[model samples]
Target: MLEPAEASPGTQAEQASFQGIRRICGFIAENFREDIDCVDIAVSADIHPKYAMSVFKRSTGMSLGEYVSLMRVSYAQALLMRDDASILQVAMDSGFGSVSAFNKCFRKKAGMTPSEFKREHRAAPPPLHA
Candidate 1:
């Protein structure tokens, strides 16, 4: 499904705030692999964390933490598509601090564990090569 970059705002001020949140989103998407927090996102957008919390929620229909989790999980999904790596490797590549964290987030967002997701989504592996 196509997700929108931003939601419609009710006023000029809200629109401006949401635009700032969009910038935060872009920054997160670009630097998600690095350790990031709401403060960093807020700073990147020239806002305070307290205010960013509200604006990001209003603009994205999700909290900043939720957005970060979603991005990490999404990246993990991409990594899981490949069969060349272990779960720990995928978790690390996807910016999760631990395999347990990756599994928990994957299960929460995908309604299944990472292994289950990979098994269900990945096609059958080719026959063993000689």
Candidate 2:
């Protein structure tokens, strides 16, 4: 996935802002599977916590929390494609704090519950053990 970067070459201040955004995005990509917040993201980008959300939102057109939720939901979607794990397991593995939270976010982003998505789109189920 492309980390948020400068849209076009411009002023030095714009260049520096894009660099900070890149660092923030890189940190998010690496740690989206872990619990993280604006403070952590700001620290990763060496920016102020209060400024992180506004900067990220301005560049990416989305809030940090929204970005994190989308990342988690995207990971859960990939996991749901396999039959080896249940929805709850996938939710936890995707870094959601609880099944309900996972379901809510997944529904918002995916337009369906995890179980429904799995049923509709999962690959062939694994062989059953004797």
Candidate 3:
């Protein structure tokens, strides 16, 4: 998975714009641990929320809200992989205010509850010391 910073450069202006958008996306992904909304992403991207949503959707083929949700769910998937956190905690930490909302969105986007996701991708324990 290439971090936004890892994207290749292009023509000067194109590269600058691409880097700008990548920085905005990276900021959102990083701050996703906090309460992030379309307005926040818009401000980060230096555009009106409506315009940001439009351009972001056109560029990514998903609405800004949907993209944020996917990013949140993706982060939750990582936490679930550890098998050390509760689903509710994962929801809260991933920016979901309520478990029901989290479950609904998770099922809609991921086709499974957080618990099911965790079970499916549970990491193996470390080998015991001899």
- Per-candidate local distance difference test: 0.84, 0.89, 0.81
Check candidate 3 and list the clashing pairs: none
Candidate 2 residue-wise lDDT at 80: 93
Better of 2 and 3 by TM-score: 2
Q: Against the hidden reference, what TM-scores do the models get?
A: 0.83, 0.86, 0.78
Instruction: Report clash pairs, candidate 1.
Output: none
- Which 10-residue window of candidate 2 scores lowest in summed lDDT? 1-10
Return the top candidate by lDDT: 2
Model 2: lDDT of residue 46: 93
> All candidates: CA RMSD in angstroms?
6.3, 5.9, 6.3
| Model 1 regions more than 4 Å off | 1-10, 124-130
Model 3: per-residue Cα lDDT over 1-130, one tens digit each = 5554775554454555565568668878888778888888878877678877766676788887788788899998988898678998999999998999899999999999888889989998899999
Model 3 TM-score on a 0 to 1 scale: 0.78
Model 2, span 31-67: residue lDDT tens: 9989999999999999998788988899999999999
- Candidate 1 or 3, higher lDDT? 1
